[model samples]
Target: MEKKKLITDDGIRYDGRKLDELRPIKFQIGTLKNADGSAYVEWGRTKILVGVFGPRESHPKHLALADRCYIRARYHMAPFSVEERKSPAPSRREIELSKVMREALEPAIFAEFFPRTTIDIFAEVLQADGSTRCAAISAASLALTDAGVPMRDLVSSMAVAKVEGKLVLDVIDQEDKQGDSDMPMAIMPSKNVITLIQMDGLLTHEEFIQSVELAKKGCMEVYAKQKEALEEHFKKTMDREEV
Candidate 1:
C-alpha cells in the first residue's frame, strides 16, 4: 500500500491520520434508563446512540416466528447530524441500513434463546462525518450487552477506505467521498468470524482481501475498548447497589 495525501502537502489524509489508522473512538454502555440497554459511540465527528429492547412479545402479524426471536434494527440519521438538515422520515437508505445492521447483530445475539419474542435495536446518528453505520453497529452490540442479552461474542466493527490510491484504515467524511473504495466489516473476534461486511466503490481481489484483514485488525482494537467499557459499567452498577 502506498501512502498519499487527501489534503495538504504533508501527505496526511483528512483527520490528520496516516493510512491504516482508525479514527479515535469513545464509547459508553448503559446510558439509557428506559431501554433494557443503551450505549453511545463517537468516532471522529460521527456520534451514534443505540438502544436495545426486548426478548419480549412480538407485536403485529406474520413477522413473529415460533422458533426464535426476531432481530430488528433501525438506523436513523438525525436532521442535524449532517451539514444540511435531513428528513425525519426513515428513507429508503435508512431502511436498507437498518436491515444490514440487523443481520450484523443477529449472529452475535442468542435470538433462538428467546423464541416467539423480539429484540429491537434503534440506532440514531447524532453527527455524521462518515463511518456512522459502522459506529452504529458497534454501539448496538454494546447496548445489547448492557441489556443483559446473551451473545456469543461482542460484535466489533471498523472501516477501511482507499485514499489517493492507498488503503486507509478509517475514512472521515471528506476522505470517504473522495476515496476510491470503502469497506466496512464487523466481527466476533473470539469466534474469529465475520458477522457483517459492506463495500462501495472498487477494488481488486487482492485489495479487497487486504482491506478485510485490516478491518479485522482494527476491530480487535475496538473490541478491547468495548470490553473495558462493559467492565466499568458493571463496576459502577455494583458500587451503586452497595451504596
Candidate 2:
C-alpha cells in the first residue's frame, strides 16, 4: 500500500499544524496521592504519567554513591498504549530510553545534596504517539520538582524532524514513521544548556543545526507550560488550605 504524504503542498501537516508548530500540550501535577510526587502530561496524542520517589536508600549497597544520589529512571509503555498491544515486558527500546531519560535529567538535579541515596523516577506511557520519550522526560522533571528534590533547573524536551524536505517541530507518529529524520532533545531551559540529543534517520549538517535550534524553541514553549502547571497546582492547594 502506498503511504500517504505527511505534509500537504500548502505546508500543512497531517494534523493541520504548520511546519515549526507544536500540537496542543497539557500537564497536571500531584495526580497520585501515594507517590511522593507525580505528574501527568498530554502532548498531542501522547499521554504519560510519572511518579518520583526518594533521596532515600539505594538497594544492593554497592550502587550507593559516595558523593551524590543516584538517579534511576524507568520508561514503560502500557500494553494498550499503542494501536497494537505491546508486550508488558521491558523491551530494549524502553531500557535505552530509560537510560537516556536519567542522563538527561542528571544535569539539573543537585544529587550531591542527598549523598548515599537515590532518586527513583517511574514513567508510564498511557497513550503512545511520537515523542513519548521527550514527553516522559518533561513530565518526570516536573514530578521531581513537585517531590521537593533540589535542582539547578527544570528540563524540557521536544522532538524536531524533517518532513517532506522541510524542518518541522513536534512531529507526530505518522511523520516519525514517514519523515526523513527525527531528532529528540532535552535541555535546561534556564541555563540554555542541552543535555540530550539523539537522532534517527539522516540529516545534513545544516539541517542538524537547524533542527536543534527549532527543538530549543519548542522546548521553551514546553517549559512555559510546565511552569504554568506547577503554579496552577500550587495555587489550588493554597486555596484549599485556606478554606
Candidate 3:
C-alpha cells in the first residue's frame, strides 16, 4: 500500500503543525481519590490515567529487595481506546512497555528511603493516538509525586520522528504509522539526565543526535505543564483547607 504524504513541501504536517510543533497537551493531578496519588494527561488526542500505590510491603516475599524499594509499572490500553476494539488480554507490547516505564522512572525515585517495599504504578490508556508510552511515563511521574514519594526530580518524556525526510517533534498516529522513524525518550528535566531512550526505524548519526535534541525540547515543554498541574492541584487543596 502507498503511504500518504506526511509532510507537505511547505513543511506542514497532516494536522497543519510545523515540523517542530507539538499538539495541545493538558494534565491534571490527583484525579483518582482511591489511589494514593493519580494523574490524568491529554497529549494531542492521546489520553492516559496513572494511579500510584504502595511503598508498602512487597508481596510474594521474593520480589522484595533488602536494600531499596522496587518499582512496578503496568501499562494497559482500554478495549475501546483505539479505533478498532482491542482484546482484553494483555499483549506483548504492553508487557514490554510496562518494563520500560518502570525503568524510566526508577532512577528519579528515592527508593532507598522506603527499603524492602514496593511502589506500584498503573497506567491506563483511555485514548491512544500515538506517543502513549511517553504520555504514560509523564503522568506516572506526577502521580508518584502526588503520592508523596521522594524523588530527585520529575521525569519528562516525548517522542520525535522522521517523516518524509524531515525530523519532527511529537508525531501523531498517522505520522507514527507512516513516518520513517520514531524515537521516544525520558529524562530528568531538572538534572538534564536521560533515563530511557528507544527507537524504531532508521536514522543517520547526525539525525540521531538532532532527534535527541528535539526530543529534549519537547520534554521540557511537557515538564512545564506538569509543574503547572501540580501547582494548581495544591492551590485548590489549600483553598479548601482555608474554607
Instruction: List CA RMSD, all candidates.
Output: 3.7, 2.3, 2.3
Q: Name the better of 1 and 3 by TM-score.
A: 3
Q: Estimate the overall C-alpha local distance difference test score of candidate 1.
A: 0.87
TM-score of each: 0.93, 0.96, 0.96
Order of candidates by TM-score, top first?
2, 3, 1
State the lDDT at 223 in candidate 3.
96
Q: Flag clash pairs in model 2.
A: none
lDDT of 3: 0.94
Give the Cα-based TM-score of candidate 2 against the true structure.
0.96
* Model 1: per-residue Cα lDDT at residue 177: 79
Residues 169-213, candidate 2: write the lDDT tens digits: 997999899898899999999999999999999999999989999
For model 3, the stretches where C-alpha displacement exceeds 4 angstroms are 239-243
Clashes of each: 0, 0, 0
- Using alpha carbons, what is the TM-score of model 3? 0.96
* lDDT of candidates 1 onward, in order: 0.87, 0.94, 0.94
